[model samples]
Target chain A: MESEKAKILPFYVLIDVSASMSGDKLDQANRIMPQVVDALAEAPILADKVRFCVIDFGSDAQVRLPLCDVLDQHSSLPSLTIRGATSYAAAFRLLRSEIEVNVKQLKADGYLVHRPAVFFISDGEPTDPEHEWRTAFQDLTAGFPTYPNFVPCGVDSANPRTLATLIHPASGPKQMQMYLMEKGQNPADAIAAIAEILISSMLASGQSMAQGSSGMILPAKQDLPAGISAHSSDDFV
Target chain B: MAAPEEGPVRPVPEGKWQGYVEPFVVGDPGRAAAGVVPLPDESAWDRKDTVLDAFALREGRARIVEVRAASVRGLAHRAYGKVRQDEYGFRRTANGRYLVVCVADGVSSGELSHKAAMIAAKGGARWLAGLLDRTEPADLPWGQFIRGVAVMIERNGRKLLRGRDDLDAEKCDVREVAQRLATTVLYAVIDLHAVDGTHAVHVVTVGDTSAWVLREGGRWEPQEAVKNDGAEVFSPTVHALPLPPATEPVPVRTTVRAGEALVLMTDGIGDPLGQGTGPVGRFLADVWERPPASGLEFAGQIGFARKSFDDDRTVVAVWPVNGR
Candidate 1:
């Protein structure tokens, strides 16, 4: 009975809420976010180890949803408001601080915290030209056990180079790496599909960590639109 | 009264659907007892021997106890058949000179891993027993022994294929054959020759499956383990025998105090206890405080609902009683 206490794997989704991602992108993000939580709720075994959160970024980013235990998280995600510009630094800053607070609360409640995973989605370039995102990203990847598996997913016009930086190669080899979604015929439908795949990967990675895996084992990649591709930094570089 | 299959029997299982092996079912919440039932004996259709229950033996100075079981998902996932891919073996020589213990885990993705897992668990113990029967005791080259086990797995796999006619009758895919039987090896030997209440042990391991000696000082380090700083993020880091990219095993030897205990387990138990995946900050104090138990009663202890667990769990915990 002593081993019955659950292990918590906090998963956060960072969705770009800038003007560029307003119509089809925002609709898909809003629609597909609930499915991620539902997938966890459906599988009790997987649900036991996972906690969910959502961060929406533009001129600023804030937690659209708090860290909700997968088993106890019944409500759907709150609709994200359209913000001014794509601010990569704002997203990273919100994520790092929110994770620190979430993880602390989880441990205080007697939960064993697995490494966190951040699933980020964006459609445009960073508005913060000061390269301030790099500083905040460094703080996110800093030492002392709050490092998260940063998996950035690119959609319609999102710069692959900036998306690549989200993976933080200097940190070391990562589990949930990065992916580029296809600019398919329908942007809304394509974004929704990519969201589904990302959520599935998050569930699989969380389950693997609980089972003593190396913390970032991704689910097998299903055949995707020919336009999509994958990239991973060797040794987290 | 079916005795152990005598002589050099065909290593390959009789036809997949032809044999009278006990059938296993997926986990059912409505069921009152454990879905797992041990085979009656090592015979056709008997459930007693197949059940991975607890087994224990006490020698002059040390006591060894082990429990092995199928993963909760593997037990519940009714894809083809519910079979366990974890195996373990223990043997003490007649002269009481050495005690050998080993554990192995078949890759979940492997096709014929249940059979291969049994081979791995016993292969090391068998080698040490046979060597003792022929040669005199001396400082064993621990590296040579692990490397030998890896080579033996590759050879015996071919021999088993040769023993069966089905392979010759219909060509089986060669790559699939190796992939289907992949498994991890953690082999160990402990000297019974205790002088002034201490015993020397040699351990060699491949992959993430681990072994640790719990010192009486409330500290623990893996037996023969190089420090893994958590830099490697790959999931399947196992150095399986005879598989591609064969990496050589490194062995380490250490002397243990009388009150110390040894823990050998597959990733199922190792990861959570050691917190390899993340920081197990809470309830660290409440983990495994009581002394070990005797029978299948230990099975209940392992079956508890740990958050980050649910694989084929196998553990061998040894305590040297006389040394204390």
Candidate 2:
């Protein structure tokens, strides 16, 4: 029974395509897309166990990349553009549909589907009112097997308060991590850090699954950046 | 039903309930002090809940519950600096049984500002718990409560800095550490009652920490002053105050009614009462006009504050459940 549960984790990258993200924000995201895909391809464990999806939200939300395994070399990741108002509600609705369909199909195939993780990067206030997104958010988050872990990364130009509201309801700010990527800091570096966090979390989840528990531990800060070497092994375990 | 036995069945006494509190501290692995002996988990005062005691009360009940959510990151220019300005706080008390919600921001100038902010939160909750033990649910004195909290913080601030080896030689006094570690604390205690009963909210703050009240009618009011015209400029280096004895405490208070939501936050949210339009202003308006869907929604609004502004921010909000 345990072996039948294929430990496949789906990661959804939700990018904000609002007009405010047009300049550096859009360029940085575009520059890092290929790197993110390449990194996943390089990690054999992640390649086998993880799937990727992309949802771009502007005046409307569109799924640029559907759920596909990294090992499938035929899959081509698409470039995202910035152009519309930030309609968070539309993006969330589309994501809910994607998750439900994929999760259902995976389950029927006897594959274990971990609650999908969402990395929502946004830089503006929602164009819609609070009520516009409430019911949809509650329903979507509730549908997950476990509470969905939504990490909303805020750009310096964006509104942090609005980003906070977009995360899953159960998580506190302490659990919501943030990093600032300046104008010249390699976009690939930031993407690498994010990839490291996600991959490391997936590996940790795998270990805990094998041990018959659901505990997960994040990698130390040094281990997260590709070039930075871990100085003190005892610092974090 | 069988006729009651002649002898009264001894009522099962309520079980003795003991509460436990612990504080866990994880220093940034990237910046561990060399040769410094790391304190044992049990020995380190970080994890112990210094304020967990129960008191006897009459059968008729009233209680207050609160929860806080916060997150912060070091500024881009200073991410690797010795002082990493990150926000930290928790929902120290939950609404279901008893709640205590507090959010504090340590002045960045203080070398140990983060530690001070954490200690203030933990200490403030303990102090509030102690106050609740003595006062009745409805009769909670807003003024006295604020004063009591001020005194407790002042005292705790003194204790936290006493005999610290980290003190600077050029500035040898507790006030230096106290002022550097000076944090603005904002907290709310909600008294819960049955459907027909009234609930009260008591809020307190010093410096620029802000509190907002949202009503069932969808109107929101600033519970505390948002802008600090005379706000003290925090200095990383401790300097002697020329104005008055540094021991005086500053206190403010306000009351909240039933079906109202209260939000407490640090300056990291920007001056909610400040001039012109800002994200904090918009957020204050949103919370005032609409009922947050959940605690996460409240937190998300606070997170939105970080995008447009650059400061370590924290917010604690409370929504009392209406009785049926």
Candidate 3:
């Protein structure tokens, strides 16, 4: 064993694969997923610190990519297809359990793991009852020491107000943010921009860890891509 | 573990180009590539400033203690073309009975935090030495002295940017500038002329800079509270100096028994070394069992790279010679 433990930052790219996202939105996401993986894989320092995962949720949620060091492998990202209705409760419940297991495994492997960050991209409202999803979201976030930074990007018919509720801690320091596509913006363009934001945030966060001052470094509001407006969880509150 | 690896491991041929050990990475070797250029800031004018520095001295009455200290700009800072934000300073009291060493890590967020680190390390050590010279240990007011140090940092830090265009000096809050120029600092005062073989070290820390006693057989016994070892997650937040004048820092007094060394360092070393049982701790404990051949070698040890731990690393170590 290399006895020397590596500091690792785990990032999950959670995407919605509901029937409404069947066309250009889903195609654009599939195309950009590889690019995101490749970009992180190319940077050795960033890759060493970042463990990337992809989870897709429709009526159910499935782990498209297991969390792994980006530097270790180069494989095609599992394609996300149209599934059933958007179930935020299912996504939240799966994420809650996966993160716990993944974080524990990383620690056992002799790595110092920082809080996981989830980049959730959704294109529709949750079909599940507000109570069911809200309960799951609360369990996934509130009072959880290893709760991930929940960044939800709303596109097309996705509700900006509904997405804002997903922000973990929901207040204070505002590590997690919600981004919405402008009313007239193209969904494909919005998906591509979210990809860009995800990459930018990961690179920035990894760079901070490399500097020995570690934390989740979110993109500043001004840095967000055009057509994507960043909102504060405080605004929703 | 087998006796700690012996003196100064030579740099691998591939990494020798950089002089320091090319840090070891778990994945692709190229992950050590250069970082984004840091945008021009207030400290940009001094970009060519020294990135690596060291200090050493041997002093005592009945027992001699060798002191070696070094500071290096972390790879992340180097990648961004930023200057090293960590600093270390030392002073021998006027009476020559005590040695004061201070190490500081400038909070990376502040534009001129490196300057703050310099002031705290150099000025804090100098100020403490001056106070030690005039005041008896029994009468020295520890709490008031630390609180005053915070005030002094605020005054000196403001003075540093006196002529800068951005500052409205008259209206600026003292605590605000202190917060902007925040840095974590650790001070270790050694009783050099101790009658007993054990040299007593009085340590005061603001923020995360820490100290430990490296006992015989390479044990890193932490001098302060160790909170992260068994915790579920690591809290990155730290309390830094230039704190409110009302906050009086506590001090940890420990004795370095014969054959033991006292080590004071910034989180650069502490975070990775964690309880000192892992690779970093084991590597350091073995190599540092005794003093290195020279200050340069000791500096090399301080800069050892492990993946994900790139930060400005600074350490001051004191070892009391038993028979000298």
DockQ of each: 0.12, 0.02, 0.40
**What's the ranking of the predictions by TM-score, best on top?**
3, 1, 2
lDDT of 3 by residue, A119-196 (tens): 899999999999999999999998888999888989999987899988765667646778889899999899998998
Model 1 C-alpha lDDT per residue in residues A1-237, reported as the tens digit of each score: 122223566788888899988877788889766787667555555565567788899999988888886445374567987999988898988888898888776665545566777778888788897569888888888673677888887888887777777774324445456677655545666677677667667656644543335365554555444445667654233
Better of 1 and 3 by DockQ: 3
Model 1: per-residue Cα lDDT at residue B80: 18
TM-score of 1: 0.64
* Candidate 1 structure quality by residue, lDDT tens digits, B1-324: 111223343457656543352222222221112322222212213211223334434554445322222222222122113355667777776676777777787776654555666676777788776676555435565557666765666566665666565464125554445565667777777776666877777777766667777666445556654323333122345666546335555566776655566667776566555532223213221232223342343444444434434456676656555522
User: What TM-scores do the predictions have?
Assistant: 0.64, 0.38, 0.85
Candidates' chain B TM-scores in the order shown: 0.67, 0.57, 0.82
lDDT of 2 at A184: 45
Q: What is the C-alpha RMSD of each candidate to the true structure, in Å?
A: 10.4, 19.5, 5.0
| Preferred candidate (DockQ higher): 1 or 2 | 1
- Candidate by candidate, in order, the iRMS in Å equals 8.0, 22.8, 3.7
- Which DockQ-derived CAPRI band holds candidate 2? incorrect
What Cα-based lDDT does every candidate model obtain?
Answer: 0.60, 0.51, 0.76
Task: Judge candidate 1 at residue A25 and give its lDDT.
Answer: 72
